[model samples]
Target: MATMKDVAQLAGVSTATVSRALMNPEKVSSSTRKRVEDAVLEAGYSPNSLARNLRRMNLKPL
Candidate 1:
């Protein structure tokens, strides 16, 4: 599975930028958002929601 880092590399942007593009498109410029979106499709990246929730709760996944 392609990770966020892969998307970031493909987009030539930081992972934080990629996250912002996805979670809050308004936070990033239109061109930057487009780049991240294209990179996501090219890299086949899928966000791990379960892991994200775990991290938010300060828990580790088994």
Candidate 2:
């Protein structure tokens, strides 16, 4: 599976940027979003929803 790091690297951005792009695309600038979208496609990245929610909730996986 492709990791967030892979997508971030491909997008030439920090992991936080990748997170924001994936979760709240409307917040990022159009240029940033375009780069992120292209990188995501090239990198074959897919966010793990459980992990995302877990991070947001500040909880560990069981």
Q: Score each candidate by Cα lDDT.
A: 0.95, 0.90
| Candidate 2 collision pairs | none
Tens-digit lDDT track of model 1 for 7-51: 999999999999999999999999999999999999998888898
- Each prediction's RMSD to truth: 1.2, 1.7
Give the per-residue lDDT of model 2 (tens digit) for 20-57.
Answer: 98889998998998998999999888888899899899
lDDT of 2: 0.90
**Which ten contiguous residues of candidate 2 have the minimum total lDDT?**
43-52
Query: Candidate 1 at 62: error in angstroms?
Result: 5.0
